[model samples]
Target: MGSREWSIEKRSDSFKAEVLETLSETGCLSVIVLGASGDLAKKKTFPALFNLYRQGFLPADEVHIFGYARTKISDEELRNRLHGYLIQEKNPSPQHSEDLSKFLQLIKYVSGSYDTEEGFKRLDKEISQHEILKNSSEGSSRRLFYLALPPSVYPPVCKMIRKCCMNKSDLGGWTRIVVEKPFGKDLESAENLSAQIGELFDEPQIYRIDHYLGKELVQNLLVLRFANRFFLPLWNRDNIDNVQIVFREDFGTEGRGGYFDEYGIIRDIIQNHLLQVLCLVAMEKPVSLKPEHIRDEKVKVLQSVLPIKDEEVVLGQYHGYRDDPTVPDLSNTPTFASVVLRIHNERWEGVPFILKAGKALNSRKAEIRVQFKDVPGDIFKSKKQGRNEFVIRLQPSEAMYMKLTVKQPGLEMSTVQSELDLSYRQRYQDVAIPEAYERLILDTIRGDQQHFVRRDELRAAWEIFTPLLHRIDNGEIKPIPYRPGSRGPAEADELQAKAGYVQTHGYIWIPPTL
Candidate 1:
């Protein structure tokens, strides 16, 4: 992507440079990669760190990586395992070689269980050996804890770290914790979970990760709204008909059947990430880009979200998670969920915020579609153009396009629907889009809390969904099953129909073909 098209401004080089300076001066020693042996660690987390190191965001020296897990693996074995996933180019440049070597030297592994005091002690000892620990004390020390384990382990792990390790440290900088998704099973649990984590760490220190927020297109929401004058006046309930957020996948749990059964689609997607994005697109502009300020506005927008009715929400499950031969079937798991939500704020009372997510259905795509209300009293057959949508595609490709009514060329006074597309590939054709984990990991070290989720925001989100979770658990709601590779349950369509909305086009972009 062009410097302008990317999340951080090209002119913000000054800001980024300032952040790097702060990080270096902060005397942070080593990054603790919790659940280091998990799938997230291998596939997303560590790769992101490596990318940041290669990009010069991380210090070449004095920075250590401690891989903490209960896998009982040797450092050599761990490095080799990590190396398998690390794609290194042949004939690396001298600079890259030097940086990689320095990074490797700082890397080590510690085996420990999240539930044990002994485990936390071992992790503490490993961290203390690093020079960063020697360099800063009390408030100035910088330690970033990345939790890549299952959500069930989050509270205990966080509590242990806080009680056993964090309290013992006198760091001058910061202590930041990054946890992965499935924040809670429902609203009340989410609140309780947030409360548990919040008690252990200050709001500023907790980073509840939603990989989507780290995405290039996702972060660009602010720039798309505030930086440009074309969208603001038009971005209100008056002009917009509805907003749709779709997080779809074509694959099932892939042996993660147990976890899928517990969280399902709503808790997995809508409760945190997708709702955060919708708020960003709909929120009033913050006075500055300060982390809390941006997050505050987002929280307000979410709080303004009207509680949804049973009829407006649709839940579905794929063929039983346990029934699949690859893994035990975990039935009664709603792998798919769709909801038509309304934000009761002045700017968006009537607009429907439609959210749909499912696994093992249709295709893999994550996008936000903003449908505009038709022009009133238009002479042209305006219903055709009434389907105008501003789509932000996140997966398979990162791009933005706006569907509008245009006069057909050489035609009998007719208007055709077409998109004003700005494909990221076509723009900056060669720049590699970094992974979410990489961007977020770098952000943690650099002290840019803008992209990470804060504790209050997490609590507010939970408050919005707690009732739905309770209803589902009480069997007041039943999941409507959809066939594999289909768009989702029939109820999903009915939910949209009730709101007078429809997907106007056949699948415009398909990932399998790509």
Candidate 2:
């Protein structure tokens, strides 16, 4: 089938109709962002909304933007704060300035407490006012409430939204909630959170957003795996040696350790982001690309993963982390962690999946490295040559490249490693790559759950890491110290070595920054 037809086939008839209507007509849509004064709102949420507006993806007159928080800020102040983050480059064009002014007019702010009914009632009144002003009484108005707040406030906020802010079902419009992750600290907590939200909304109405899943490279994993003939036979235990799903950041939290300390590197990055990538890399092909069908495969792969052993884990905290004014002096929170997972299924029984994530590391990168096993017998005496590797760099310049051995250019019979690269900047230079938050927010607007995590998938993911998390917390496992600029704890290298990963000595991938 052609690309357009295939895409239509993937979506439900109702969803296709909705998309068509949204594109062709001006519908009443209100996007209410809770915790608007926070960094996440300014840095990501508002910025994404503005981009959508600038691109004409959002209706000009029929849509409204509401920002709610406990802070007593006027709409002008909120817009000013959001303006700096809304795509104004060092040298913006006159059209960009015009677009910014137009986008700012759509946003309005409301001061409110998350737990109180009165505040939510006021919010509801504000939302309804827009509907009334647009003369949408006869037409339906969709409401999307984005919870940009912390997990601690999720229950009360969700309750408030359900009780006071939800749209009436009789009005023909629907209500959807977009939740950010660290879904819960553990499996039980996650289930409880899910149950609470489930009480208010159905499965279809809840979108568990993970920005990583919205990444262009991550979204491409399925297509790269299934559509490419080269990868089909090589993506198995017999051919693949080990997979390394790594996330590294060069910068430490500059006095912003409150949240990071509460949920260490494991809960912060590995559990949700890296594991989601793992599922995509290892999952069996779904029967179709339907949301539930794709999620079923992800759940299956997660279920097959055996509990990670303590011996296979390495935890590290960057030196001077406790010295951060915001971090407690006695904090044992891990700024870095590397753990090995062994899937017990037939296709991947012996292969080790190493998940590594860290803050204050050597460089900023998030990449999946799949190292294939070496040839049984080499004819050219190239045993020293590294095993083949298929790498998908998720961030810091998205790209995919395969490392393979080839004969050296000289008369010598020696081999050298070369890459068949597909750097995004080099290939799709003119195309704009949307931010993760942008794509995810757009998906939520379209009511597409394929990129969002399902409740079962969330639970299964937590199940894999919760025990290890508890052990680290209960046992107060002291993380080894590594300097802020270093790679990570020395033991992390040892852990990888023990897990059968062969690091190439001379080869390094320096991604092109465009």
Most accurate candidate by TM-score: 2
Leading candidate by lDDT: 2
User: How do all models score by TM-score?
Assistant: 0.90, 0.94
Please give the lDDT score at residue 61 for candidate 2.
78
Give one digit per residue, the lDDT tens place, for model 1 in 1-514: 5555465555446766776777667565568999989888989888788887777676656467889999999987888788756656786778766666666666799998898899889887777657545665545556788998988899999988886666344555667788887777765667788888878887768777788888889989999999989898989988888888899999988777766666667887777778888888888999799987898898788888877788888888776556756444435557889988788889887889898888988888899988887778878865844577889998777789887778889957887777777787766555577787887777777667888777677777777788887788677898877788888888788788788675664335422221
lDDT of 1: 0.78
Model 1 C-alpha RMSD to native: 3.4
| lDDT: worst 10-residue window of model 2 | 4-13
lDDT of 2 by residue, 1-514 (tens): 6665555455544654566476345348899999999988988889999887876667677689999999998999999888888865889899999899989999989998999998899999999999888877633788899999998899899999989987765466778899998899998999999999899889999999999999999999999999999888888998998999999999887767987888999999999999999999999999999999999999999999998888999999998888878888888889999999999998899999999999999889999999998788878665576788999999878899999888779987788888989999876664578788888887887778999999999989999998889889885567999999899999999999888898887878776666
